[model samples]
Target: MHGHQIRRAAQVDRTELWSDVKPGSLYGALHRMQVEGVIEAVRTEQEGNRPARTIYALTSAGAAELIDHRDEALRDTKLRHDPVDLALQNVIDLGEDALRAIIVARRKALAEQLDAWLALRELAAPHIRGLEWTTFRHTELRLRTELAWHDELLDQLPKLMANQPTSMTTS
Candidate 1:
């Protein structure tokens, strides 16, 4: 595919699971991949009034490398770091009202995102394969987990606030 074609295909990728393919970065990424011998320019074609576009095809090495990377990622067991955990660790700095407000806002955002994924899934359900469907499901599951965590934190806020130190002490 050419850069424009690749970018067009990226538009349907709501998951953004691997990498966020931005329009501006597509050409640069294609160039780099071609230079690395993972992809090659197949041919240049012009469609009437349109400018010539170089088509690219992945090399055999690229396919092998992709499989290796995918397998390695699947084998990875380390938890991804989230900045929310850091903020929660220092939750003593925020008052109960402030923490509650943050959690509420977070829940709203997560709910909105979940709604978007559901809409997309519904729209694409007829066209998508099992793996693609699972991508949507995976995102839905994560969003639900985070929303539940927020609800639980809200429920525990009173006890958490009561246990917080009234003043900071020097060591």
Candidate 2:
């Protein structure tokens, strides 16, 4: 439909899946797609009191490209650039209490993320129906998976701490 609709769809389905699905990236991609003859602007019109909206549709090339990219996306697993992974690799830079604090903070943040997604799912379920409900379901599942992984790390931290040198130990 329009850019807002496109953004709404991406926010639900692709937001957490892709790091670049934010508003800036969405609009930028639309512009690039138009430039590359993948999509065309049909018209812009004001609806009610809102600002004007431009409706875009896929060109023939766009349609073909969409099918190819969608298939490739489904087949490929993209690597994530997670800050937690970076921290895990260099945690020796921190002292014992610092590492413990970091772990605790990370765990809390992950719990909050799970709670937020679950709350969003609850808020969205009544108004959204059919296949749309799966959006919330999928996001909740992803958040839960991440939370579980975080908790697993927390559980292992004590053992990890025990193996570290005295410099890494906290009283």
Candidate 3:
């Protein structure tokens, strides 16, 4: 697909939900893959009033790489960078007021995410088939689980901070 087409598909699939797949990163990846001879330009075509763009197709190497990456993606239990965890490590410095502010903002973001996933699931359930539907359902379930966990965290935050030194008490 062309640049705009790729971005459109990513938006439709909500790729940013599970990743940091920005347009800049996506385009950069395409260029890097092309440089590595994994993918090559196929043909350039303009659809009616649209500008001509380079179309790309995977090379044999690209297909093989894709298969290998797909396997790792399915089987690997990878740890992702969670900014919240990093912040918690410095919870001592965050003072109660600031920490509460952070938690509130995070809770709001998580709620928004949960709602987005729920809406996506509703959209996908009607059109997606078989295994794809099952995968989408699994994703929806994960989102619900995380959302619930955030509620628990919010409930326990006050107690967690109680033991930690408060800025007012320190100075």
Candidate 4:
């Protein structure tokens, strides 16, 4: 479930999954999950002459695992990275305006995600009951926090970029 959500949310292709999961690798993690009866992949035929794609679905075991790890997953910070950090790391190579443009674009993308997250939360409202509300609430809080963070970053970017030199010369 986590793997699927990560792939879908990041809009990552199979090749990019390696970077997303690193260490044990996405394939290795998926295989391990399957072996442990967490998830099962169903083979589905694709259009044209292409091979079938494996669509993963969470098993009962998988749902239980997700529930068990929900708190840990929410608390884990080591697996995450801020794109702003990546951009700043390469700021010497990418001009301030260029990096600012990237931030604006990322902000737009995150806004779209927040919209989707809100829609999902709305849909889950009546459907989620009792203890499930705790999980849903956590998910909603995380999404809202992320949206707020993005807004804050976008707000602060201009001030941070103001003092930075925008041009570089080749020797």
Candidate 1 wrongly placed segments (more than 4 Å): 166-170
- The TM-score of predicted model 2 comes to 0.71
Give the alpha carbon lDDT tens digit for every residue of 53-166 in model 2: 889998999999889977998799887688877767666666667887877787788788878877777877777878877767776787778878877877787788667555
Off by over 4 Å in 4: 1-79, 165-171
Clashes of each: 0, 0, 0, 0
Per-residue lDDT of 1-171 in model 3, one digit per residue for the tens?
887888888887767765677877887878888999999989999989978998988899999988987798889887788787776866777766787787778778877877886777787777777787777777767767777877887788778888866553554
**Could you give the candidate ranking by lDDT, starting with the highest?**
1, 3, 2, 4
Candidate 1 local lDDT, 29-98, one digit each (tens): 8898899999999999999999999999989989998899889988999998999988787776778999
Instruction: Please report the candidate that would top lDDT against the real structure.
Output: 1
Candidates 1 and 3 compared by TM-score, better number: 1
What Cα-based lDDT does every candidate model obtain? Answer: 0.86, 0.78, 0.79, 0.67
How many residue-pair clashes does candidate 1 contain? 0
User: On residues 1-171, what C-alpha lDDT tens digit does candidate 4 reach at each position?
Assistant: 344454564442223422355534666878877899988986544658865556678899889877877677667779577666665755866655777687678768767877786777687677656776665566667767776876786678778767656555544
Residue 113, model 4: Cα distance from true site in angstroms: 1.4
Better of 3 and 4 by lDDT: 3
Which parts of model 3 are misplaced by more than 4 Å? 17-21, 24-26, 47-49, 165-171
